[model samples]
Target: MQINQQIVLVTGGARGLGAAITTTLVHAGAKVVVNYFKSHALAEQLQQQFPDQIFIYQTDVTDKIEVEQMFNAAKQHFGQAITSIINNALVDFKFNGEDRPKLTNLQWSEIQTQLDGAVHACLNTLQAGLPDMQAQHFGRIVNIGTNLVQNPVVPYHDYTAAKAALLAFTRTTAHELGEYGITVNMLSGGLLQTTDASHATPQVVFDLIASSTPLKKVVSPAEFADTVLFFLSPWSRVVTGQNLIVDGGLVKG
Candidate 1:
């Protein structure tokens, strides 16, 4: 299905990359359900911009019950099953490598939180949204990931480990769901130029990354979000179980 005919649920779709995805999809005429954990005001503001096209809802995607409720509400609001989902919600984390705890100091709880955000969040949404997708015989699932799995420049052990698990989940889900006309894939990116999560990163690091990239620039959230459109569009009907890195050729693999 094309974007206009799809109703998309974007977890954490109020700020940063989530906001960019919401804007991009809405502009393309997709009905969007913007899920936010705490960005009530920002979500409301985004809804105001495209009140008719966007449905702003507050829900913690990690909580199975809340996710179910959000899915039901989205279906009721749109009078149709959500045709796509962007698993973009992540637990609060900053990209300041210097401030991050050393491997010896990192706690299991830290790893658990990332797993909750990365893996568990995806699980809850898949379970809640799959029935509809099966009924319609069409669905698109795009899981947001990080290039740190391949190029762990900072070695965010907990975060990278969790994302690696998400990668596995993406492929496994694709294998299981493709028979039902659903496509599951991942879009991994490098340190975004600027986002709430990366604001703590020093400007020097950003400049260094930009200089190293073939594009000579750090990728913006909007630019990365634009690629999401292709995955959700009909052109990707046969594409699944792939991880497409969007880091401006910093890592060719």
Candidate 2:
């Protein structure tokens, strides 16, 4: 389906990278359901910018019941099943690596929290959305990931491990759902220039990354957001179960 014809549901679509993706979709004429856990004001503000194209819903994605309610509301608002989903939510996370718990100090609960955000939340949405996608024989699923899985320079143990598990989920789901005409993919990016999550990152870290990448600058949330368009577009119908790194040549693989 063309972008303009799509009905997309973006989790955590109130601010930062999620907001960027929501804005891009609205501009492309797609009807979007912007789901947020908190950020009600920001979500409302985003809806104000394009009231007709954006519908805002408040729900914690990690909760199965909340996710179901969000999807039901989205379908009712759009009068159609969501044709695309961008799992852009970063539940309970910050990018201040310097303050991250040392390996010996990290708790299992911390890793579990990341897993709940990355894997469990995604599972809830996928299952909730699968029926409609199977009925229509069309769907696009994009899971946001990090380059740290490949190059764990900062070693965000819990975050990286959770995303790695998500990548595994992405490919396996794509393989299983391919016969039904659904495509699942991942977009992995390096430290984004600045997002609510990344804002705590030291400026020196950003500069160090920029100096190492071929682009000679940090990638912006908008840049990462734009890449999401391809996965949703019909042009990517045959592309599935793949991770596309969007870190401006920071990780070639």
Q: TM-score for every candidate vs. truth?
A: 0.99, 0.99
lDDT at 172, model 2: 95
Model 1 misplaced stretches (Cα beyond 4 Å): none
Best by lDDT: 1
Reference-based lDDT, residue 112, model 2: 95
Candidate 2 lDDT: 0.93
- Candidate 1 per-residue lDDT, tens place, 1-79, comes to 8899999999999999999999999999999999999999999999999989999889989999999999999989989
Model 2: ten consecutive residues of lowest lDDT: 93-102
Worst ten in a row by lDDT for model 1: 92-101
Q: Would you give me the overall lDDT of model 1?
A: 0.95
Writing each residue's lDDT as its tens digit, candidate 2 over 1-253 gives 8999999999999999999999999988899999998899999999898998999999888999989988898899889988888998997889997798779999999999999999998899999999999999999999999999999998899999999999999999999999999999999999998999999999999999999989899999999999999999988999999999999899978
